[model samples]
Target: MVLRTARVGLRLTRGQRNRCFGLLRAAGDVWACILEINSWRRRRGEPPVAGYQQLCRLLTESGPGTFAELDTAGARSVLRRYSDAWFCAAARRKAGHTDVRFPRRRRALMPIRWYHGTFALDGRRLRLPTAAGCPPLWVRLDRLAPYPCETIRSVTLLFDAGRLWIDITAELPVATYPAGQQPDPDRIAGVDLGIIHPYAVSTLDGAGLLVSGRAIRAEHRMHLADTKNRRKAVAGRAPKPGQRGSRRWRKTRRRARLVEARHRRRIRQAQHEAATSVIDWAVKQRVGTLSVGDPRGVLGLPAGRRHNLRLRQWQIGRSLAILHDKAALAGIRVHLVDERGTSSTCPNCRTRITKPAGRTMRCRTCLFAGHRDLAAAFTIATRTPGGVITTPAGMPAGVVTHRRAGRHLPGAGRSRRDPRRPAAPGSVGRLRPAPPPSVGSRSSIPPGMDEDPQHTTGKPGER
Candidate 1:
């Protein structure tokens, strides 16, 4: 079984919100306490405590109710988080990475987790464990958890961008299909990951698929433009380094956070949709193994500032991860292969040709031409860590499927327009007449007409 997590927002009353925040703050306090203990130890030239058992012992010795509303389970989760972070930093440092730092910074809120037995999930309501003698705390979820209740293993309470969300983790079995519907183990496909087209796929059967990311790119651009304009508008209100800002500044910051969070959510949902499309397509095509081109090697190189920002916004790592997770659940095996020469190698002539700047690649030697990403994906299919798998060198397939990701994003569909963009110069925003009132209603009278029959718009009330 594989694990998946769904983040669900919380709908809380004032008191519930306060209590939830208290729990998160208590988790933060525990984190700070751990850091303080470690700092003192470091100053004394002692090895810092980075073990869960030791931390739990320390917590027990400190007695119960040390953290307000934080139960033993929640507090232990925080301890585990700190221990994990400390060890992770230590490992990186030992591997000749000096930049990695331990968790020294304190937070006002830290996520707390509770195992299955410690929490109760009933429809939209959740019962969280609290400190001894504290009353039971029940918080409502804005929506039901996506996973089956029995499969849920844990729930994590986290605060993000001024909102409270719970991450529900569940164990799920891989997908199974009946006879003739299951993917054939011998069928293989190649995937080329790119910025414009997030997934370019080709198979030996002359079938191909391309998932466009143009909508996602537009979202990023619009959000970036909006951010620049917002910064400029707020520049005058920004306080000096030491000066305290008024309430307006805080309000502005809060709105900015909400906007940022919404952008992230939109992008995340779109990516998921894209990955789901790929998986569904593969399943329909009965593809069992996917050879994915890994482009992370060149990501570390110094690119121009503009290109670097584009790469960062591309979020290639997340894309790969989401695809992998979806593929795994669909019972498809994924393999990552070097994509260094995939683009330059010609599928038609099997000869080296300089990569083209645009989406179409031409091989002069064989007088062959085809879609660039698809050709690259086809070439990549032949290469694996074990060596090339012999297959028919095929040109770009004419029977290709086109799909668009982020179609639900702002300005993605024709029905919706991005709010970030202003109205056309000298043009007004969208305007429409209100629907006509019911035929028999007296309120349907136009503004120019009088409500009373005697006051009708006539020279002498002829009616």
Candidate 2:
């Protein structure tokens, strides 16, 4: 069984919201107290209490009711979070990562987690465990939990993007298929990850699938433009460092957070759709193994600001992770191999060629031309670890399938345009045209400049 977590928003009354935040604040206080104790211990030249049991002992010494409305189990979860983080940092540092730092910073609010049986889940309403003598805290979820209640392992209450959310984690069993319809382990497909085409999958049986990401790219660009415009509009209202923000500034910040959250949700949904498409295609083809090209090594390079922004928006790691998780659930194995030179090398003759500027990749040696990303996938398929690279019969002729990732995104459908964009120059519902150039006046001149061209009845070739 694999563990998966889904976040659901909370619908709460004013009192419930306050109480939830109170619990989170109490958890944060617990975290801060631990950090302070560790700091004092370090100052005294003593080993810090980073273990979960030791921290629990310390918490017990502090006595009960120390954190209002926070039960012992809930507080211990915070200690567990800190201990896990501290040990993770130590491990990373020991592995030659000097930049890794222990958790010492304080937070005003921290997410509190409760394991199964500690919290009560009843359809849309959750009963969170509170301190003894405290009234039971029940909050409603905006939507029903995705997983069954019996499979739920834990729930974590946290605040994000100006709203409260609970992440429900559940253990799910791997999917099983009927006999004679199971995925063939020998049948493999290569996946090429790209910016424009997020997933390009090529199988040994001469089939390819391309999932376009143009809508996602457009969403990113539009969000950046909107954010820049909003920031410019509110630059004067922005509070100076160490100064409290005005009410208007706070409202603007809240609006910004909402927009950011929406953008993130849209992108995440589209990525999942893209990954699902790839998995479905693989299942139909009876392909069990997916050879994914890993491109994370180049992300650390100092690209220009524009290129860096593009790379960041690409979200390559998340895309890969989503695909990997979905593939695993589908009983398909995913192997990430080094993708260097995959796009440039010709799959047929193995000759290195310059990366194409567009989607088409043409080989100078073998005169073979195909989609660039698919070509990369084909090459990647051949390089799967511990797998033979034998070409299937009639390999050059593959059935190509085209699919789009963000069809639900604004402006993605045929009948809908992005509401965020202004109307086109000649589109309907736009304001009426200006007076039809005023009967041969200078207003009819084309857009290059304001100057009116010299009018004459000259024929062709006349200056």
The residue pairs that clash in candidate 2, if any, are none
Across 1-463, the per-residue lDDT of candidate 2 in tens digits comes to 8888999999999999999999999999999999999999999999999999999999999998999999999999999999999999999999999998999999999999999989999999999999999999999999999999999999999999899999999999988999988888889889999888899888765588877777788899898998999999999898999999889988988999999999999999999999998999899888999999999998999899999999999999899899999998899999988789988987778889999886677789987777778888878888767644554332365666656777777756432223345555885553223334553233433332211112211110110
Local accuracy of candidate 1 as per-residue lDDT tens digits, 1-463: 8899999999999999999999999999999999899899999999988899999999999999899889999999999998899889999999999999988999989999999899999999999999999999999999989999999999999999889999999999999999999987678888999888888887876577777777788799889988999999999999999999989999999999999999999999989988897899899999999999999987888899988888899888999999999998999999998888888888867889988987777789987676678888888777764666565655544456667788777645422223234445554353223335653232434532322212222110010
The CA-based lDDT of model 2 is what? 0.83
Cα deviation of 315, candidate 1, in Å? 0.4
Candidate 2: TM-score? 0.89
Local lDDT at 193 for model 2: 94
Candidate number with greatest lDDT: 2
